[model samples]
Target: MEGDVWMKGYFRKRGARWSFTLDIGRDEKTGKRKQKTVSGFSTKKEAQAAAADLIAKFEQGQYVEPSKVTVNEFLGDYMSVHYRSSVRPGTLERAEHMLKNHITPAFGHAMMKNLKPLHFQRFYAEKSEAGLSPGTIKGMHTFLVTAMEMAVTWELLPNNPARRAKPPKQQQHTISVWSHEESEMFLQHAKGVSSYYLIFLVALYTGMRKGEILGLRWDDIDFEAKTIYVNQSLTYSLKELRISEPKTKSSKRAILTPVHVLQELKKHRLRQKEIKLKLGTGYDNALAEKYVFTTSKGNFIYPQVLNKALVKLCKELELSPIRFHDLRHTHATMLLSLGVNPKIVSERLGHTSIVITLDTYSHVLPAMQEEMVTNLETAISKIQTVL
Candidate 1:
């Protein structure tokens, strides 16, 4: 009875109780003739106020369908808008796989309004129990949290529930590296193997990553200067080698090789020249680009293929088994054991900063404490004599 736009309200005959409701009608700014409505207001003043509020909200672009969005939908939109173009193709593919295989299937259809922190906590527990490593589960949580942050920006949700979710605590673990004896034995075995042996040597000496090594070209090598340029990384897609710029600007620079490594490289270059001459017309066109290393067929050596070769070598040598990547750790460990400054090691490794180098190699350099004490003692002796 309040107004035509108002719907019927509740009233008690004996107690004089009153209830109010609002009737909302949408207004189209243009001539599309579209309209929307919601009803039930008891008082005329209340109805008018509700109408004004709705108009202002709609004008301010505050109206949103709370039920229209699902977790999957939002994640998809966010990936398309924010992440699709920003990451590498491999990275994008991995993200998609993670979302589809682990994240989206579980919560993809869940309504944005109903998601809660406990749901994610349960998810973390389940994933951990299922044998997923803490590091990988942590990555999943990170992706979820980032996606929820986008939700907040979009005003689809009031807050990020994922922020409150407690992920499993990560455990610190160290991987084993080659001892000096083992390292020497491995190098001895690699002698006369091929220029391919030089790959592992460079990895152990320079701490360069496998991708960076595979990406190296003759132009990047300065034999006279005893330096190697690291401006790119090689990746594979659709069964083809693709050379992409390094992941970071810090990764793009020159690193000096040891005198011994330079000598080995000189030998390698000569061997490569002979192979090129022997192949004649059968040599690959790709090999003409001056890549420093390649397969016998003159194709870029894939990282996986190199890893398999390392595994085979490790097995034959009866060495304490480790991943191909552990060679980099071996290099850092040897350097730090010799009391090398962490700053110098970090620069050679092309780490973005010294902190990363220290964090990674600190465990391998436990002798640093003794070295520091010795230096301090020497300094104190000098000071006492001066006094």
Candidate 2:
């Protein structure tokens, strides 16, 4: 015998066991009527207690409907709807690659509700064992956590299992940079033959990011003030270049350039003007937008082009091979080595805080410490002689 009222739940005897069923209202996700049913209870009271617990969970908004949606399905929807518009094109592209190449292969078919912290722990362990860097695994973890948080928001899961999963610890490695002498030599060699000589010089002198340098326009440079305004970054996606605001508020700044660098920039402008005049109406004015640096045809230069040029120049000059980005590091390292205030270097590098600058260049500290001790020893010696 059982009660007919749905809220009160019902119980019936099935041979040797008591069965209970509680209607928990319609599933909002599937638009289907839902219920919680359990069999094999030893007694009617036990069955009734189980039914009451299920009802309490429903009333508390903690009940998650069993969903057939796979992690892949949720991630697909998340990317298309929740994530696409909020991030930069380059970032979005990287996220997609992480999803397709790593995440989707591992957990795509697993049901969202069925995913557990153990599953993710195993995933991280496997990725670590396979020789993937902890930083890359951390990135994948971040993406998964974000997606799962959205699932929690949608009430598809009671909580984000990703929050409980542990990923491998990130390992910090030493950063490499060019010496001042090496940088000067490279710039000299670049000026002799490279069309991107000014771009490389700016990177080394100002520490502007690749995107910021590529986005620079003639108007953003103030010759009178000897400052370059970093307000935008040029990003490439699908073979098309577009200007976007700087990555962070700190990224938008005014950097004072060396007088010699500005003088060279003035020369560069004159050279560009001469080329434009020679091309007449054939110049790609629509693509250039008065950009401070561009291809001979007046199109914005791609990042890959800069990297290839730097590689070729280094090989030709028999210089140590380093990435174009190492130039920015070279700029910061040089400033720190010269006893320039770290805060000033931080601002020039567009870092959010001086702590980031200090941490990133901690390797340079031992040399600075030695110089400080030497200066202190000299001062103390003078005082001792006087005494």
Candidate 3:
């Protein structure tokens, strides 16, 4: 009853207990008021002390509303208001899965206003220790920060909890391509066993992606011109084979086939004509989907089916197994070894720019350093002779 309250009768039932009651009515001039009544005490001194401490705490701004906001609520608001419209469908699906499976479980029940940097730090450390790969954890961290950033923009949080949270270090993995000898062996094997040896030759010579190889049609090739146009790619979507425009504008450029490869193309064309005549009128236009690579039934070749064949063939030839994609890598590697300019290789490979080509094939270009040294040595020798 410091201001306008009452102290009820004391009790000694428990070891030590104290409580106070309050009227808490506002002073008219001040218009400030509060009311709480708690009455249980073993001694008057203890009750007074306890009441004083309670009043002190209430005076300070140390208390917070438990139900202010939760991480779950914030996540919902973040996704619905910001992410759904901005990201692509595939990217959104990955984000949604990451949040639901990884993020929400770790921080869902936490009060948004009370979330701290230490909580995020501990969570990231524990995830790393649990054997989650750094790249995967980094992806989750990116999603969380992205969502919380939106929360800040919407005024739901004062600052991002993920600030200063360091992402895990990623391990560098080297990409491997076939050696010259291995490529030659594989080409010979393809020539002897696969009816589509020209397909393999074209891939080795042109550095086209597997999808691009499968998507090549008769109209895209000009026999007299010795040029192959790459304007579309084959992909499986909706459980059916479909042809779609190249993934990027840069991927639609034309490539000039080497004269040696042109000779092979002429032979392959004659073989195709023989096969078409043998099939007669039964060779329907639908059957002529004009695929450069296909099965005996003339059906569009699936990537998985081709990959299986490549693996089986490698095992039979006693060669170390390399992914079908490595065929393209082999092509790029050979061209760089031959001292072809990266700009020309980049255009042929349909990369967006030379920088991308150089970055991807940097390991293969270390010989260029020795070439530079040779040039420098020759210049120095010429200057010394003149002197």
Candidate 4:
């Protein structure tokens, strides 16, 4: 003990065990004196040393009163008081599912103060062993780190146990839109989740150009095949609107459509039908076979009109102004980065050769090259909350 140290603790023994008692401080809420009793030490020296360490923490204002709140109790408070307002509805739902299915069963009953780095580390390792992806473990780690941080702010814990824990590192995955080759920076986080996301989804999910999208016809979509056949493009040639062949022979290929996009397309068709019925004979029902998208009067939606709409929508959302055509580049970049075969991406994008696809999206290929050794595609799938 130091000469200036004023010890406020005592030691005792009960049968084979040694114990120590210390007056830590007063409760901030009740203004009552607080004491701690630590028992089950093998020797008086060990008890004395432990009590001395705790006294230093108490004097330095780093000690927290022991909380009886279990991990479950604190997680409930964290979700209601913090997550409900802090995260989006989808994020909140995912978090709730994680808590109910994965976290609660693991160590939710353990007292908050009793948690240690080893507990979290072991849990993450066990999860990885059970075939849960590193991404899921990383997400869970982030949640706990945030929750434990809040627990410290609320005086429920001395420090964050999760912050000291080590989690498995996952690959860095991000979606961004780049400008024209070797030009300048463009939009970084274009997730296509806005109110007008349906049309944007078509461009981003399929690598179809604005002209190809504008020229889509009811005959081109095969509902049974779940495919969108690209045959013609609405081109403004010689200052005249003309339905011409695609830029290349490969551009007239068929691309498989995602179910989400197909469902949205069906809904869009229904809305279009309702508008046609309202207009009656004023609408050009004849254009239904020639054009899938149109104005209220069933006039064709030109490429420039769609471009203007995209620019205005980006401004309203405070996002970078990307033209309707840029979404095609974004789609190619995302697929290439995901380790999808370049040849397959070329076929979907209607590129004449895989070399052209490579030349255009070469920037996203280096990361995929590394992914080849890691085989991340097989490992990183849907991050299920189920154990």
Question: What CA RMSD would you report for each candidate?
Answer: 5.5, 3.9, 9.7, 18.9
Provide the lDDT at 136 for model 1: 89
lDDT of 1 by residue, 1-387 (tens): 222333322221223222333323434575443344444545545545665665666668776445468888888789999988787767677788888788887778999888999989999998899899999888889888988888878888767899999888888768679988898788888775634689988898888888899888889999888899998898875456788878777888789889998898778878777877898767774664478778765778878987777877888899888887899889988989888888888888888999988878778566888888899999999999999
Better of 1 and 3 by lDDT: 1
Tell me the lDDT of model 2 at 315: 97
Clashing pairs in 2: none
| Residue range 155-187, candidate 4, lDDT tens digits | 999888999998999875433474333111222
**Residue 157 error for model 3, in Å?**
6.6
User: Which portions of model 4 show Cα errors greater than 4 Å?
Assistant: 1-6, 25-33, 172-387
lDDT (Cα, tens digit) per residue for candidate 2, span 7-68: 55677787778887776678889989876777999887887788887778878878877667
Taking all chains together, each candidate's TM-score versus the true structure is 0.81, 0.84, 0.64, 0.49
- Please identify which of the two predictions, 3 or 4, would achieve the higher lDDT against the true structure: 4
For residues 147-181, could you state the per-residue lDDT of candidate 3 as single tens digits? 77776766676577786687788887566688889
Candidate 1, run of 10 with poorest lDDT: 9-18
Flag the better candidate by TM-score, 2 or 4.
2
Which candidate wins on lDDT? 2
Better of 1 and 2 by lDDT: 2
